[model samples]
Target chain A: MEQPMTPEASLRLIDEMLQQAKRSFSRMSFYFLLWGALLLVATLTEYAMNRAGLPNGWLGWPILGTLGGIISAVHGSREGRKAGASTFTDRVFMWVWMAFTFTLVIIIISCVQVGQRPGPWVSILTAMPTLISGGILRFRPLILGGVLFWVFGLLALFQWPEHGALLFALALLLGYIVPGFLLKRQEDGLRTA
Target chain B: MAFAPLDPVLHNQLRLAVISLLVAVEEGDFNFLLEKTGATRGNLSVQLTKLKEAGYIAVTKSFKDNYPNTLCRITPQGLSAFEQYVKAIKSYLDK
Candidate 1:
């Protein structure tokens, strides 16, 4: 049975819901924006280093997939449990991180086919995506992972070109592995709590 | 000035569990409430109606993915009720 609500009561309810939604959504917006910009910077830097003849650019593909994988888990384990949906900005950061990482990897693979070494130009191109991912996550784990990967990636560039692959592997593990493990642990604790 | 604690009106564990979960998310889907609170469909439906009648929450029925969705968002009144519940429960510890 439908009981008709007076127009006044209906208006009051709407007003209350709107006000509550505004306050809650606004609080979440600040965090999303802060994380979004950081993701942007990372993606750009990673891409730049790869395009400049870097031999290790192929490694950025799995790295990008890894970032996306982390985002998928994050949405499931953490954000799903949250009070509200992840904002538009947060989704943007996730996609951008994926795009940059994938692009760098594809570029590097193309270069490898030509039997090229990733030069200073290539390394510069590759820096963009790592920087983007680190900035976007805004959590300590990802930030540290990005910085470590970028720094070590750069350092490996200075050594023999052949070692770029090894360096990329190490950086990938550092950038993605540690952070994923940490977040998993945190998610488990939250679930149990 | 501190006010005297009131006795718990809705002592049913299911209702209390629903309230506890809502305090965390501020809003939760009916399915989530049922899952987390471990309440049966009929029990959850009854208790949710009671909470709504008491002005603790506003439940909205909608469709998501062509499936019926029941979303429960806590009202300001509900938040206050949960807060007072905490204070009242804590009075026992205070003694």
Candidate 2:
């Protein structure tokens, strides 16, 4: 025979159950944003690098820039996971597709740049497919970043081709840096509440 | 993995305490479970091994930073078993 459980004990049990549900939902949403944003950035960086003719040697600059974005994403995600709050599945398919798109975009952008074209118009023109696809996917962060890239791309063509690289880097700041901090805050809120 | 219902260990109070704690926490180290359940080391280890061998939980051994770690997570089967135990206990209380 067992004694009756106290009210406090029962309430604690309920609290624990609620916490598990919150964690599961937050985790799934976090992964969707993290992977989706990363895939877009990787594709765009590679395209920009080839358009700028920054590649000097055997390895193309676009390839290096895409690789750099991947490393940044992996490091950022691992830190979040160690915080034991916001880990999620790595979207392998999404990443592979990103790499393939980068390869194709670099080829096209390089062709345009090699033709002695100077301006953001070429970059903006190339961005249409990504912009439409990102918006249709309902991935707000990626769509937002793609739009910023498109704006900077137009700037390069119309206003200053020389400033394109700097403006593009600023766009990355708005995209990953801001959202990553927001996600960290969101996780902390969930844990505390 | 499907765990056999009515396993004798599932009926024991101390073992049930450990399982219930694990079910809620996701994963816990041995000392954490011992602290939570108030079970002695030998008894907790025996019950954990039984649960692991029964495929109702997975025990991962590693070093966190530097110190040793023994992390245990309840399997899907364990969650069902825990839920069943809750239902059974409620029925018994109702009687």
Model 1 global lDDT (CA atoms, 0 to 1): 0.55
A1-193: candidate 1 lDDT, tens digit per residue: 1234333433343343333333322122222233333333344445555567655534544465456457555654564444343334445666775675566667666766886654333345545654565565455666676676667667766764555555654555555555656655654554444
Relative to the true structure, candidate 2 reaches a TM of: 0.45
Worst 10 residues of 1 chain A by lDDT: A23-32
Model 1 ranges with Cα > 4 A deviation: A1-143, A153-166, A182-193, B1-3, B7-12
**Candidate number of the best DockQ:** 2
Candidate with maximal TM-score: 1
- Stretches off by above 4 angstroms in model 2 are A1-11, A17-174, B1-47, B62-68, B86-95
Please give, for residues A1-193, the per-residue lDDT of candidate 2 as tens digits.
1234433443345345445434432232343345435534554555567677766322333565466557656765665334332212224324544664566466657766687442244345435544443454444664675577678777765687666655555554554445445556666677667
For candidate 1, give the lDDT of residue A36. Answer: 32
- lDDT at B22, model 2: 64
C-alpha DockQ for predicted model 2: 0.09
